[model samples]
Target: MPETNPQSRTGLAFGGDYNPEQWPEAVWSEDVRLMREAGVTMVSVGIFSWALLEPAPGVYEFGWLDRVLDLLHENGIRVDLGTPTVAPPAWFYREHPEALPVTADGTRHAFGSRGAICHSNTHYRAAAASITTRLATRYADHPALALWHVHNEYGVPVSACYCESCAAHFRRWLADAHGTVEALNEAWGTAFWGQHYTGFDQVDPPRATPTVGNPAQALDYRRFADATMRENFVAERDILHRLAPGVPVTTNFMTALSQCDSVDYWAWGREVDLVTNDHYLMTDGRRTHVNLAMAADLTRSVAGGAPWLLLEHSTSGVNWQPRNPAKAPGQMARNSLSHVARGSEGALFFQWRQSRRGAEKFHSSMLPHAGTDSRVWREVVELGSTIGALAPVAGTRTVADVAVLWDWHSWWAQNLQWRPSEDHDARERADTFYEALYDRHLTVDFAHPEGDLSAYPLVVVPALYLMTEAAADNLRRYVESGGTLLVSYFSGIVDEHDAVHEGP
Candidate 1:
C-alpha cells in the first residue's frame, strides 16, 4: 500500500478548496494574503476546472494553472491538485452526449450539473484518462504539490446508469463474476418470474418494470456500478502513481449515511493512498454531533485505523439543506476538533472563500461573503492556530472500545424494491445502535462483515440483510473465541445472492 499520510510542511493539513479561476488575477494575491492570515497550509485546486483547462477538445490551456501553482508555492501553501474529471467541458458533452448517465426511469441527465457521467462510457473514460495524464505530467514536480485529488466526489448526485452501454458493461461484469449465464440464473433465482437468461447478452440493468424486479439483480447492479467507478479511480490513480510517483492519490468520500450510500468505502479504502471524507451536518432533527462522530469513526475505520484527512466540512452551515442554519459562535472549532479527536490528520472546509454567484453561493466557507471582519473569518483564523498547536496529535490512532459491522452490499439489498417492510431503514438502525454506544461513551470502530473481529471484545451488527457464508462463519468464530456479539432484528436472513438462507 502507498503512504496514507499527505505530503505537508506542517504536521497537520489545513485550508480548503481554492478556485482562483472563479476570480480575477488581481484577487489571487488578496486571497493568498488572507489565507496566510488564517494560517492556511494547503488548498485543493482544479477540482472542477476541466472546462477551463481544456476549452476545446485536444486544446490544452496550462498558462493560468501554472500561474496559480507558482503563486501558491511562493506563498508557502501546499496544493492538493485535482484531475478535474468530475465536470467535463460542454464541448465534450456536445460531442459525446451518450456519455451522459441515464436514470432507471430512462431520463438522461443534463451536463449542466456535476457528476452527470456514465462510468461505463468509453469516451468519458478516455477523456478522463487524457486529462489526468496531462495533469500528472504537467505538475509532477511542482513545488506546491502535496496530494492528488482524483475527482470531486464519486457516487454523489448520480451513481448508476441504465443506458444500453451500461447494460452491456453490467453484462460483462456479471460474466466475470459468475463465469456463465447458468450460474447467474441460479444466483439470481430467475426461475421465479421466468427471468432466466440463456446467455450473457440477455441480461440488462434493472430498468423500469411493470412489476417489482428481482432483488438479486438489483443487488448485483449496485455492486457492478461501484466496481465500475472504482475501476475509473484506479485508472487515474495509476497514471498519477507512474508520473507523480511519491505524491498520494485520493478522491474525497461522502461517508455520511445520509449523504451517499452508493459507493462502498470498504472497497474504496484500499484503492486510495489516503482515505479522506467530505461530511456536512444534516439538520433533519437528529443529533448532528453524533452523526458527525459516527461519520468520522467510520471513515477512520475504512482506513483501517490509519490517520485520514477531513477533506471537506463546513465553516458554518450549508446551502443545499432544507433550512441552512449558520453554526453557533464556537461550533466550527468544536466540529473540526471532534473529527481530529476521532482520528483525522487535519480539518479542511468545502472552500476557502465562499462563492459570490453559483448554486453554492450561500454555502458557508472559511472566508464568508461578509469578508475578513466577519465571525467566520475570525473562527477560521482561531481554528488554524488551534490546529497548529495540536500538531503533536498527528500520526496518532484512535482506539475504539467496540466494533460496529457495516456493509454497503447489505445496505443495497435491504433497499431493494420489496423487503420485509418499507419502514425498516438500515441506516436508521445503524444510527440508533451507534447512538446507544455514543450515549455510553464507548468509542466505536466500524468493521466490514467479513473482516477480522478478534481484536474487538464486543462486536455489534446493527443491520445486515445480506451476509456471505464466510461472514457468518467469521461471526461464529468470534463468539467461540470469547468475543461478545450483539445482533439486531432482520439480520443474516439472506445470503450474498439476496436469496433467503435455508434452515434459519
Candidate 2:
C-alpha cells in the first residue's frame, strides 16, 4: 500500500547495481551499449560512493556522478540513486572517532569495513544528513532519478552498540516505552536476582554478566538495537521524502541474514515508500529457490501485497559463500520469475557487470568478466527478453490465502539465555510453517501480529515466544471471526517483557 508506481523506467524494469565509476571513462560508453543490448531498464547507483562523493569534510564531488547519470539517461536507462551514506568516508572516522560502533564486550569496531559507524552516533547522523541534503536537492528534478535506495543492509557487520551515547539513547527510548521506573521494574522483573534499577542510567547493555544476563534487559537491548537501526533508516528516508516528493524510496532487506535480526522489517516497512529485498542463492544448489520464494513472500507481505523491487541477487555463484556453485542452465530465470510470481515487479542482480578487481570480483554479474560471449551474459540478455514478454505482471500483484505471524520481538525474546530449548529458532520455525504451506501449493503472507489479518482464511503463527496483550486479543478476534489459526510447537510462552506467560 505504501508503494507508488515504480517511477520512470527505461525498458522492462530489468537491471541491477551499475558502477561505471569503477571503470575508465572510455568503458562507460561500452557499458551503455551493453545495457541497451540486454534491455536494461533501471540501475541502482552511488551506494558505495561516499569517499568519491565527499573527499573531505563539506567537500563534495558530483561532477563524476553527473556524467554517469547523463550517460545512463541518454541510453534510456533510469536510476535508483542511492544516498551514499552506507559507508562513511575514512575522513569521517578520523574527524569523529566516536562514530564507530562498540561491540558487546565494549570494544569499538575497526574502520575498514562498510558499516563501522554506530547507528546512534550523533556526529555520523549530522554528516549523513548533510550528504542527503546535497544529493536530494541537487538531483530532485533529474529525469533519471526514479527511486531512492537508502543505506545498504543495516546491522551488516555489527547490529547494536554498547557506547555511552547508545546507552543514553536506550534509556530515553525505555522511558518513552515504560513511563515510570516502578513500571519498568515490574515489567523487567527486576527482583529476579536483585538487579532492580533505581534509575534508567543504572542499566547497561547485556554485557558479560556474572552469568546469563537478565532476559528482560537483554530483550530491551535487542529492541534498542533494532530501534537504532530503524532510526538510521528513518533519518535518511525522511530527508529523501522531503526533497524528492514523488519518488518512491527503498532499502534492500535481507530476511534470512543473521546480522539483520536487529532490524525489525515489520516496523521498518512502514517507513519506506516501496518495499524491496536482496537475496542470494545459498550454498545449496538450485534448491535455493525455496528460500528465494520465502524472501519474496515475506517482502510481499511487508509491501502489503503491492509490488516490491527484487534489488539484488547473484547471476551465478557468490564469492562470499563457502561453496560458490553457479546455477545450472535455466535456474537463474526460474529463480527470477519465482520472485516475480510472488510480488517483485522488477528483476535485478547485485552488479550489472562483474567487478574486475576488489572483494566481489569473483561474484557473478549480469555481464560477466568473460564478456557477452559467456553463458552468464547470454542468459542476462535472454532474461531481459523474457521479462519484456511478461509486462502484464508488472501491474498485477501476488495474491495470498494464508498469513504467517512474524515478530522481531518474539525472535529476540526466544533467543534469550536459559530457554526451554536452545535449538528453537523463531525465524526458522516461521520458515518451516511457510514451507508447509508452500508444499501444499498455498500462497502465504508473513503478517505482523498487529498488521491486517482480515484478508486471510488461515493464519499460521510459529513459536511466538513473546506476545503483547493487544496481539493476543487480535489473534483471538481473528479466530472468532471464522479464521483458522494454526499454531506451531512453541507458542505464547512469554509476555512482551520476556516474562513467562501466566494463564488465567
Candidate 3:
C-alpha cells in the first residue's frame, strides 16, 4: 500500500514467506484472509515458481500467478517475487545438461533441492534471465510488487563447477591475474612437489586429489567459485534492474553457510538495490544473537549502513539442522526484537503457512498445523500488529564502531589449499572475528576487498591466507594512518596466487 524505498519509514515489514502456488485457487481467498488476520503486510510469492510459470520453456502461465498477485493486491499486501532460478523447471534441467551442477568429485548432481544449477552455466543464466525479465516487464508498474527476490538461498555445498565453460573462464581469470602459466606456477607454489602447471588447463579445481595436492591452488579455485556465484547473482539481477528500474532487488543470503563466501556475497550485494538475508539460529546453540547481530550489521554495512530486509527465518523451528529445534514460546518475538535492536530494518519469517508435504513440510510457520488459531499464528499476528503500530521505531540504525575485513578472496585463499588445521576454516574464522566484535557490542560490517578502507575507525583482518600485494598495502596504509587494525594469527600468510608468504 506504500511506496518501498531505503528511506521509506514503513514499520518493520513483518510477514512470513507465502506460497499461494502450493494450494488450489479455491484456497487463495482463505489464505489471504488468514494472512490479514495474522497482520501480514508483505508476501514473498513464487520462490519456487519455475514449474508454475514455465510448464514448458518459453510458455508463460500468468493465470494462476495473476490471480495470486491480484488477490494479494486487493488485500493490501506487497509481493516480493522470487526469480525462481534456484529450482528451474524439471523440463529445463532435463533438456539442458549444462544446467546440472558439477560436484567437486566430478559428479553431476540430479535435481532435488533448490540452488542445484551450476552457477557457471551460461545457458542457465540466459534462461534464468529470460524468466526474470518476464517477471520484471510484467510487474514493473504493479504497486503490489515491492522487491525482487533473486535465487533462493544460493548455497554451494555441491563444490565448484569444473565444466568446460567454467574451466575456460578460470583460465582467462588466471591469465588476467598471473599473465602466464609460469607465473601462475610460481604463485601457487607448484615447486612444492613439482606440481607446476604447464598451462591454465593443467590447473584443476580443489576436489578429490587436487585439494590434497596444493592448498593454494585449491584456495584460488574456491575464490574462483565464490566469484562465479556472485557473478551469477549480478548477471541475473542486472536484468531485473534494467527492466524494472524502480523496484529494490536482493538475494536472501544465509549468514554463515558453507556454500558461499559472505565477502563475495557482499560483492553481489553491490548490484542489489538493498541487502536482504535469512538468519536461522538453532535454538540449542549458544549465543544465537552473536551471529544474528553480525548478519544484521553486515547487511546494513553492505547497503552502506542502509536498512536490509530480514528475508527468511524459521517461524517456530528449523528442520534442516541435524537436530531440529523449535523456538520457545517467547523466543521468536525476542529474536525478532533482537534483530531490530541490533540494526535490522525489518524481520520476516520463512513461511506464513506451514507446508503439507515435501522436505519443508515439518518446518514451522505462522499458521501452524492447527490452522490460524494456533499459538504460532497468534504470535505472528501480534508481532505484525506491533510492527505496524511501531513502524517508525522499526527502521532505526545501529552506529557501528568496528569494521571487519570480510574479503571472500581471503576465504578462498585459506581453504582452497590444504591447510593442516581444520579449525581454521574460512567460515569459522570469519565467525570467530564477528563474534568477538559482537560480544563487545561493537557493530561490525563485512567490507568487500575492493571497498574503500578509510571509513572504519577499527579494522580487523582475520586469517588472510591469500591477499594481493595491493590489498596488503591498503591495510598497511590504513594502520599507518592511525586506524586501529587487529590482524589474526595467520594474516597475510599467502599471496593472491595462493603461495605462502613469510614474515616481514
Candidate 4:
C-alpha cells in the first residue's frame, strides 16, 4: 500500500529505520521535513514498540502509530511495518512470569533486555501470534505500508527457553524424530554409562555444566533450539500472510549470525517474499575492504543474490562496539558505496534520528546533536542526493559464480562440541571458505541449503559436520548435474544428530 512499489528494475531505496516513539509527537512533521531534505525514502517502524503498543495484556493502542504512519505517508516515504513482537510488554511478563530465558551460565534472565522470550512457550507463542495477526489485519490495507518486518533479529543473546515448556517441546521434538525413547537413546549414544532413558521426562537440555554427557544429545538439543526459533519466525510470518494479502513479509537478518542460521532461515524465507539483513561496520578492526566486501556480498547472497536491503547500519560511530569511533570524513559514503559495489540494492541505517536515552543514546544517526547543521547530516544529505541521482541501477544482480554455505543452526550445533579441533567452529571455517573463494577470483554468494543451488557453477560446503541426509542428497544431485561441489575438512562426519558417521 506504499506510494511507490519496489520498482523491480533497478535503483536502491535510500533511508533508515525511524523510531518516532523516541521523540515527542511534536517532532513528527519536522522528522518528515528533515527526511525529505536528507533524501530518505523508506522507514522501518514499530520495531521496538511492543511494550508501547500493548502496555497491558489484551489492550492495544494505535493512536501514536496512526499519526506516525500518516506523517511518513504525507512526506512520500514508504514504511516497512515491523510486527511489534520482539520485546513483549511488561504486563505480559508480569502475568505469565515464565517468559524469561535461562542463560548458558544457569541464570534465569530478568525482563530488562529485549528479545527475551522463549519461542516455544505456549503462552509466548499465543501472545506473539495475536499481536502479529492484529498488525497484519490493521495495516494490511494501509497505503503507506510497503513490507512487513517480522521481528528485529530472530535469535538475540537473551532469550532461549530452559523452562518446563521448552523441556516438554524438546522431548516432543525428539520423540517425533526418532519415534521412541529407545531409538533416541541410540542416536544420543546414551547406552554408554547406563544413561538410557525409559520415558520422555528423562531428557533434559544439555546443561552448560555437562556431567557424563552424550555429545550427540547436546548436539541434537542445539539443533532443536535453533529450529524452534526459526519455527517462531515462520509462525508469525504465516499469520501475517494469511491476514495481509500481497504485502511482502520479511525478517531483518544479521549476517554470519552464529546463533541462528540464515541458511536454515532461508527455508522460512521461501514462505515469505523478500529478505533483508543488518550490516553494522563498527571498529577499525573490521574496516577493511575484505570485511566490508564480504559483509555486502553475504547480504546479497543470503537472498540468493536477489538484491538485499542493507538494514541497520550506523551513519557514524556505534556506541555498542568496543571503543566506538566515528566514521571518518567520506567513510560513511565509502561504506554505503561498498554495499553497492558488492551487491546491495539498498542501504539503510539503524536510525534516522538520534535517541536521547537507553543503551543506544550515543549511537550515530542521520541527525546528530547539532541537529541538521552538522557534518553528519551534511554527509547524509549528500549521499541522499547521490542515490536519488542514481535511482535507475537498483535491482542489478551481482555476477557470482561461487556460493559459500553458511548455516546458523549448524554453527550452534558445532559449538555444542565438547572438545573441538582448533577450527571446529563452523563460522570461522566459513570465513576461511570465503577468503579462499575470494582469493580464487570467484564472486561468492552465501548459499542456504534450502536455496537454489542450480544457479551457481561452484559451491563450497564448509564444515558439513552435522550434514543432514537431505542436504547431502541435494549436494549429490547438484554435482551429478555438473555443478562444481567443494566439501571442506570436517565434512560428512555427522548427521543432524551430531552422531559420528561411518565414512563411505
Candidate 5:
C-alpha cells in the first residue's frame, strides 16, 4: 500500500546518513538550510536509533522521526529510511540477555556496542521483526521515503555467534542441507577424527576445540552463519516488501574483501531490491583509489552491472583506522567522482554533520565541526553541485572489458586454519590482479564462480581455493568457447565441501 519509485522523484541521491536525533530541534532548521545549500537530494535516517526510537519495550517515539522526514520533504530531500534493527535498545537486551552473541571461546559479547545480536535467538528476531513492521506500517506512505535501508552493514563487528541457540540452529541447517547425518559425516570427513555423528542432535557449531576444528565443519559453519544472518535479512526484507509494495528495499553492503569477509554478497545480491555499498578507503599505504575502484566495481557487479549507490564513505579519514589522517584538499571530490565513474548513482558519506559525541565523533562528515567556512564543508558543497550536474549519468551501466572471478565462500575456506601458507592471502591476490588490470586501463566486472561468463572475452580467476564442480564446468565451457581464462595457483584444488577434487 506504500508509494514506490521514490528514486524517480529525485534524479541522483547526493546526501549522507542524517542523524538529526543527535542534535536539538533548534538545529533542525539549520540542517535543512545547509542541505539545500549543498544540493543534497537524499539522506539515510534512523539506522542506529533503536534506543531513542523505542525508549521502552513496545513503546515507540515517532514524533521526532515524523518531524525529521517532514523537514527533509519540505526541503525536497529524499529519505532512505532505516529499520534501526542493527542496535537493539538496551532495555530489550536487558530483558533478553541471551540475545547477545557468544564467541567461539564461549565469551559473551556485551551489549554496549552495536551489532551484538545472536541471529538465531527467537527473542531478537521477534524484536527486530516488530520494529521493522512498525516502521514499515508507519512510514510506508511518507512523502520523503525513497528507499528502505535495512539493518546496517551486516556481518561486521560480529558474524557468527557460537551459542547454544546457534548450535541448535546450525544443526537444523545441517539437517536441511545434508538431509541426513550420514551425508554430513561423509562430507565433513568425520571418519578421520573419529567424530562421526549418528543423530543431528549430537552435532554442534565448530566451537573452540583442541588441535583445530574440522576444516569442512569450519567451512560449513561459515556458510551456516552467513545463511543465518541472511535469513534474518530476508525476514525483514519480506516485511518491508509486503508493507511497502512499490518502495525498493536495500541494506548497505561492505563488499570490499577486507571490510567484511564473512558475508557472501553473491547470494545477498539476489535478495535486495536495490544494491548499495558502504566503502571506506583502507589508507593502508596501498593505492587507495585502486581499492576504491575495486570496491565500486565489485558492488556494481553484485548489482548485476546495474547502477548502484555509494551509500556511505567518509568525507575524510575514519576514526577506526590506526592513522586517521584527514583527506587532502580536493581528495574527497576525486574519491566520490571515481565511484560515480564506475556506475554509482551518486556519492554519499557516513554522516551529514560531524557528531559532537559518540564513538564516531571524529569520523569526517559532509558538514564538519569547522562549519561552512571550512574546506571539508566547501568540498561537500562542490561535490553536491558536481553530482547534480551529472544527473544524466544516472541509470547508465558501466561496461567492462574483463571479468574477475570472486567468491566469498572460497575466501572463507582459504582463511580457515591449516592452509598451505599463512602468507597466501586471498584478498591480497584479488587486489593484485585487480590492480594490474586497473593499471592497464581495462574495466573489470567481477563475476560469481558459476555465473554466466559468455559475455566476457577475458576471464581471470585470481584465487579460488574452493570451487564447486558446476563452477569448474562453467569456466571450462567459457575457455572452450574461445574465451580466454587465466587461473591463479591453488585454484580449483578443493570442492565446495573442502574435499580435494579427485583428478589432478
Candidate 6:
C-alpha cells in the first residue's frame, strides 16, 4: 500500500502542545532551544489561547503568536496551528448570555473552565466560527503551519445542555431522524411505561427527573450530542478549508468516552483529514501498555488503516490522577514506541513544558518543572532521539489476525437506567478479552461490528448489546462466509434504540 501519512510529511511528529504565549517573549527563545535539544519536529501551537488571540470581541492580536511561530520555524520545528476557539473569551458570555451551557440540573455554566459552552449553543458556535476565521486568515500562509487543530477536546465536561434552545433542537433532531412521532414512539418502545408521545412538541430533553428518566430518550440525547459536536467540527473544518485549502484539520479524541457518547470517533473519522487521540496513562500501572496499544489500534482503524497521530499522552504522571504515581524508568519511552508500533506516525504529549501555574501545574511535560535536570526531561530527550531512529517504521501499515469490535453507541446505551446486570462494564469487558489475546503474543485490530470484518481470522465482540440492523446483517454475512466469531455475554440483544430484541 502507498504511504497514507499526510500530517507528518517531513518526519515523525514528536512534539506536543507548545504554549509560548503562556511565557514572556524572552522564554520563546529558550523553549525553541529546548525543542532542538529534545529533537522536536512538529508541535501543536495555541490550543487554548483564545483569551490571548482575541482579548476582546471583534478584535484580533497576532503580534506575539507571529513571534512564537517564527521562533519555532527558525528552529526547524513544524507547527499544528491551533485556532484558539476552545475557550471563548470572558467577554463572550457577557455579550451573549445564551452562549453558556446549561447543566442537566438547569444551572448555566460559568466561563472559567474549558468546554463550558454547549455544542448546540448557536451563540457559542457563531463565536467559535468567528475566531477560526481570524486565525485561518492570519496563519493560512505561515511557513511553519502544518495542520489545523480545531477547538480542544470537544464535549469534555459540559457536553450536554438542558437549556430551552437545546431542548427544542433535540426535539427537532428526533423528528427529523425518526420522521414521525409514531415511528419514534415505536423505536423508543415508549409504550412500556405509558410514555407515548403525541407530538414532537411534547418531547423534552432527558433531563433530571424525580424518577428514572426514559432510557430511549437518553439514548437519543446521546446521538443528538454527538451530532451537535460534529456540526461544530465541520463548521470549523469548512472555514479552514476555505482559507487554507490544503491544510489537514483534526481534533483530538480521548481514549475513553468522557461524555455520554458525545463524540462518535468512528463517524468523526470520516470528516477529518487524519485521526488523532489523547491517551493519559492509567497511573495505577494497570496494563497501561495494553490500554495504549488498544487505543492506537482503534485510532488506526478509525483512520481506515492509515497512519494516525498520538496527539497527547503523558511524559510521566498526570495531575488529574488520584495517586499520581510516576512511570517507572524507561516505561514512558516504551509507552510511546508501542503506539508507533501499532501505526501511529506521530507520538506527542499534552504540553511541551510543565506548567508553573494553573490546574495542570503538577502534570508532567517534555521539560519538567524542575528544569532539564529531572528524570522526565532525560527520558523525553532519549525518546525524541529514539523516535528519530524509527523512520523505517513510518508509513508502514499495521495488520492483525484478530479483531475487537467496539460500538460507542452500544456502550452508552447498554447500562442505562436498568439492565440484566448492573456490572455491564463494556470497557472492562473489552479489556479482559484484549488482555487474553495480548498475553498470548497475538496482535489485534479494532473494528465496529457494522464495519468490514473480512480482514481477520477471528472476530470478537464483548458487551455489544445494542446492535443496529445493518450491523446485524453484516455479522450474519460474515458468519455465513465461514469466519470464526467470538462474543461475550450480552451481544446482539437489542436494537439501536435500547429496545430489546424479541424471542430468540
Residue 27 C-alpha lDDT in model 5: 99
Candidate 2 local lDDT, 1-504, one digit each (tens): 122233554234799999887999999999989998998888999999989999988888999999998888777788899988888999899989999989888888878877787888899999989999899999888878889988887767677889888888889989998998889999999898898889988877787676887888888888888888888788888898898888888888887534267778887788888888888877744346667788888888877778788889878889987778888998899898898888788798999989998888999999998898899898889999998888876768777888889888898889888887799989778767777788899988888897779989999999887888889899999999999998888888888988878878
lDDT of 1 at 72: 87
Of 3 and 6, which scores higher on TM-score? 6
Candidate 3 off by > 4 Å: 1-9, 157-159, 257-263, 425-439, 448-457
Residues forming the 10-long window of minimal summed lDDT in candidate 2: 1-10
lDDT of 1 by residue, 1-504 (tens): 122223554578889999999999999999998998898888999999999999999999999999998888888888999999999999999999999999999999997879999999999999999999999999998888999999878999888999999999998999999999999999999999899899999898999999999989999999999999999999999999999999888899999999999999999999999999999999999999999999999999999999999999999989898898999999999999999999999999999989998899999999999998998999999999999889999999988999999999999999888776887878979999999999999999999989999889999998788889999999999999999999999889899999999983
* lDDT of residue 236 for candidate 1: 95
CA RMSD of all predictions: 2.5, 2.9, 2.9, 2.9, 1.9, 2.9
Candidate 3's residue-wise lDDT over 1-504, tens digit each? 433442232666778788877777798899888888877878788888899898997999978888788888888788888888888888888888777877666788788766677777888888888988898888777767888888887654454676667777787777887899988877777888878788787765665773366766666676677677778788877888888877778888765433235346656667777777788885446577676666667667767777777877776877877888777788888888777776666678888778898888888888888886677877887888776776777656666677787766677656643476867876676778888777676767777545677878988877766677887888888878888888877777767666666766
What C-alpha lDDT do the candidate models reach, one value each? Answer: 0.92, 0.84, 0.75, 0.77, 0.92, 0.84
Estimate the TM-score for candidate 6.
0.96
The residue-by-residue lDDT of candidate 4 on 1-504, one tens digit each, is 234553221367789989999888898889899899988888899998988887777788988998898778778788889988888888888888787777655667788778887777788889999999888878888778888888877765543567667888998998888999888888877878888999988898766654646777766776677678878888998898798778888888776443234235555446557778777763556325566677778767656667667777788888876688788899998888878767666678988888888878798988887797899999999998887876777777788878888765666567664646745877667777777777777788787765579988889888866677778888889999999988878776777667777766
- Comparing 1 with 4 on lDDT, the higher-scoring candidate is 1
Candidates ranked, most accurate by lDDT first: 1, 5, 2, 6, 4, 3
Evaluated against the true structure, the overall lDDT of model 4 is 0.77
- lDDT leader: 1
Clashes of each: 0, 0, 7, 6, 0, 0
TM-score of 4: 0.90
Q: After superposition, how far is residue 334 of candidate 5 from its true place, in Å?
A: 0.8
Worst lDDT 10-window in candidate 3: 1-10
> Over the full model, what C-alpha lDDT does candidate 6 score relative to the true structure?
0.84
Off by over 4 Å in 4: 1-11, 210-212, 257-263, 282-288, 439-441, 448-457, 468-487
Model 5, residue 223: C-alpha shift (Å): 0.6
Q: What's the CA error at residue 30 for candidate 6, in Å?
A: 0.8
